[model samples]
Target chain A: MFQPSMQNIYRYFIISLLITVAVNFSAAQNKTAGSDKSSEVKWWNGFLVKMDVVSPVVTGFSDSEHFGMEGSVQFNLKRKIFPVYEIGFGGADKLSSNAIRFNTNGVFQRIGVDFGLLKQSNDKELINNMLTGGVRLGWSNFSYDLTNLSLSDDYWGGSQTLNFEGRSTTKTWYEIVVGIQVQVYKNLYMGWNIRNRHFFKEDTSGNIVPWYIPGYGKSGSSNTGFNYTIGYHF
Target chain B: MKRESGNNDYFNFKNLFNILKNFLHNNFIKSTVFIWITAVFFFSTSCIVSDEVCRKEKNSRLKVGFYTAILNSSTGNYTLSTLSIDSLTVNGVDSLGNIMDSVLYNNSKNLSSIKLPLNKFSNESKFIIRFNDSIQDTLTVFHTNYDQYLSFECGIIRNHLIDTVLITNHFVDSVKIQEHNVSTIDAEHLQIFHN
Candidate 1:
């Protein structure tokens, strides 16, 4: 079993926090040098439509083992809090070294909120940039097929082949996400985020569990993922 | 005053835009993106190759240990201790009293314990044990077997629960069931005691 160490989690969080502080400090310096327009507080700001650009490249390199593509809509509120809804399709076709084959494909969803860590500034350029940290709850319900499973009785002189088709299961996990987004052009942004995902429950003994989860990467106690995204702010 | 300030703010915004455009064109951002993409590719590849392999034991067998009862002189009590047999031969037998072709132990010498495989298709297993090629005993074991799924790589294994054991008291004195459940775990399941 591959277990993510607590020390690594702590180190990731510390690095994210330091990056947030550094970006915030730089934004503050720029704000002091720019014009001082009266801060306008709007309860509802427009949302951004974002698409992940990294998944396809990864899938292509994975040699048909893993495939995933996802998009998200994030609503900006008072330029501080962001509520997000993400949806995606993911699948896996894996052949074990022992010749057992597993196949599955399904849709997954995630709902979360992000808090902007930088201080609000009136500069038009600075207002569009954000350093955020968030939490997400993700879920997927899917079915899988496993074949070429063979069991032999060496002493009894017999062998049996077993195939399990359409084994259904539901999985849920939580993520700690941290990212920085910067405006590249008018209403266009480019960003990258790192996620630390943890599963709520694991498959019990004697049950056939999935080798790969839809939104969650490989099925394990925990995993780490990275996403590069391009977005258009409306 | 408001109009002049508005014009000045517009000029500052244009200057900031130009600075950002130059920043994006710099080599730093370009290299960062390239490095990130490379890292992501390697990370995904590493995940794909790191598949779990089945390394656990898969064979299920019954372990029998030889023991003897000895009188403790000072305590005036009898204690059971391990016994090593001088010569032993064991073979499987059918219900019709015909010996099977497989020989579990072929005249083995100086063994304190021996492991034997039970029948997966039948409810009972019979074995003939010959001591020094002279004194012989027949041991019959009644067991119920079930399949247990271990993992994808390991597949399934048959586990047995011993219901009863019958042994003819020839060279063997008595038998006791130490552990009834038998799976891949290597442990003593039965103890055969001799005088």
Candidate 2:
């Protein structure tokens, strides 16, 4: 009887230890969950810096080269999606008009979100993994200074000097970015994004014709591009 | 005797090959280092920094200059300096400098603008033209024959800040017409009377 009682007591002690660990883990998860609901920029433990090669396929410029680069910074709102701000720079437009060169080299700044859609299997016996997916919508305000740009009768064969300054305008655009970021290697993530831009409206305007956009060159409609990025979090 | 001599000859050839191999190996290593050094020197010298002045030709003329301000946004009324004149030239700016479309200034030529050097210029010191009515005007500026472009200097004095503008009136001309809309204000409108 003494031996049986002792065995039963030992089993109870082991079960109680297990319950304590489970409760502690659950409390920790709840604490993290509470924090995630507070801010759009605070879902993650740290931030991510991403670089992507961009190809803008604005409609008409299909046969031409419209390669570009985007640099973005994201702050997490939940385990997956985070608000992001991006700036882009690249070579000039591949197509130049009689007066405008496709020299599209400039800086583009953007603000949006990176949506994380895939959840990784937790290595720890206690943690359960979750997956999330979302989209980013924001406005893009960007423009190039035409003062440094020269418009010539040069393309169509005219030597007449063009006259226009202070004649330039500041243009605005809007974008919808959709991305899938997944957990891969210990806090190291990989994501792919495709963004669409609807660019129109000018703050000031004059005589010169606006340059064509990549993917939708001069179609003056919507434009789209894709990005592949690798990031690590702290 | 012939077979043994042939074998001896083969050994000699192998020795020669080994010597040449060692020589080639050392030479290639040296050559690679030399090429790398040459590349470093050539690439380092490629970029050269030089300086050029960015000032345009009109900056020298102190020409085609004027200071006007908006006093009443609702009325679209403005005021010009007492010595408001038209048409200056500079090798510095647009072919057609500043020109008013319909407003009237008594003297269009022999342009003698009042050279009032401003002592100070601040957001508060608004030297404005208080027009009695709304007028659409463009300040026509040009450089004088000896001038290139204009410069405006503003300074703060003891109590009054002054502004000075340099303009050249050698090449351009100014004509002010008071009517922005001919249907509302006709050509007879003028600013000929100022005390």
Candidate 3:
């Protein structure tokens, strides 16, 4: 006799749910685009506040060792340019595969400007959508504790363990961003962006490198980040 | 009435198909695709994490030069010159006063220079050196070992500073410390004089 397994049933259920949501979302988007009307211009309408919901959600869903949150405020100029300030808090308690452990929490901030690239048309002047390319300068200051770093000699018969506590450092970096924003409601927007981050200064003189940075993902030669944001217009 | 409804449905399908085609050709979609492709290419090409291996054998060993007191006819005195030791054997001594056999050389015939590794964890290294002259000398090296962290891949290496060297006068008449800092860099650290 043929039978469906529990895992198969769950997978089928999720697939059907995703299809239904996609269809409904497309229909809502068409209706909103057809009915949206232009509002009277005001100076305060250019200001916005946004929260990066994806970063917090991703950090929450991750396994033990990491947590993060980020938010930003931006000003639109001439509907062609945007100036933004973003702030975030992050922490990690990780034991590396080699048994080296590190624990830290810190704050990071970034200031940036975004340029709109969407072509303007008289017919779609009422639509509030943007395709943006931007650049950011980021900074973070943090203290960390590294423990259980073991050292052993191959030829000589001896071993030692080392620990460093409250080591403090400051870092500066820059990021190039590419993203899009769409007006999902009268005064609400949903957007997503991808950023390429490069470090301006990193300390490698010590034997250990910082495994994770606050705003940055993994501390490496370079890093990449993705953010999904929800915003409200004033 | 049914035929007319069928034709209307076909016209709506053709209009939807044209809309999809126009959306595919939109500038925003094209730009997004370009950026994503560039990002993927850059990520795949640059995201390489490599573990560095320790290459230089520095500070790991101590070098000693063998010198003989040869008579110089021009100066009318014995001067130091290179001497080759034959049938040399070196052994280490344990903390309990037991001889740990062949810590450096095992009845090997050394020509001129030999590199000997110091004990990493211990502050003292004791060696019994024997030569073909049927003479045995006890050489004791007093040192302090400092922990040094290399990279993650290389782990920890110990650096040594020689406090003092004590040697029994047998075949070796005297000892001189030329360099006290012991590291992996190959340089003569001591001079053993044979008369």
For candidate 2, lDDT tens digit of each residue in A1-234? Answer: 456542354355345434433443454466578775423433445777776633443212435434555677877654445677777654334323323233333445666554332222234521112222233343323332232332122111222222223333334566555444544667666656544456555323223434433222232344444566677665
The DockQ score of candidate 1 comes to 0.23
Tell me the TM-score of each prediction against the true structure: 0.78, 0.34, 0.64
Worst 10 residues of 3 chain A by lDDT: A36-45
TM-score of chain B of 3: 0.73
Model 1 off-target regions past 4 Å? Answer: A1-41, A118-123, B1-49, B94-98
Interface RMSD per candidate: 6.2, 25.2, 9.5
Ranking by TM-score: 1, 3, 2
Compared with the true structure, all predictions reach lDDT values of 0.81, 0.37, 0.72
Better of 1 and 2 by TM-score: 1
In model 2, which regions exceed 4 Å deviation? A1-43, A55-67, A95-102, A114-168, A200-209, A212-219, B1-195
Q: Which stretches of candidate 3 lie over 4 Å from their true place?
A: A1-45, A53-62, A116-134, A152-158, A176-194, A207-209, B1-26, B37-59, B63-88, B95-97, B109-115, B131-139, B151-156, B163-195
> Which scores better on DockQ, 1 or 2?
1
* lDDT digits (tens) for residues B110-168 of candidate 1: 99998988987788989999988899999999999887777766766778999999999
How would the candidate models be sorted by lDDT, starting from the highest?
Answer: 1, 3, 2
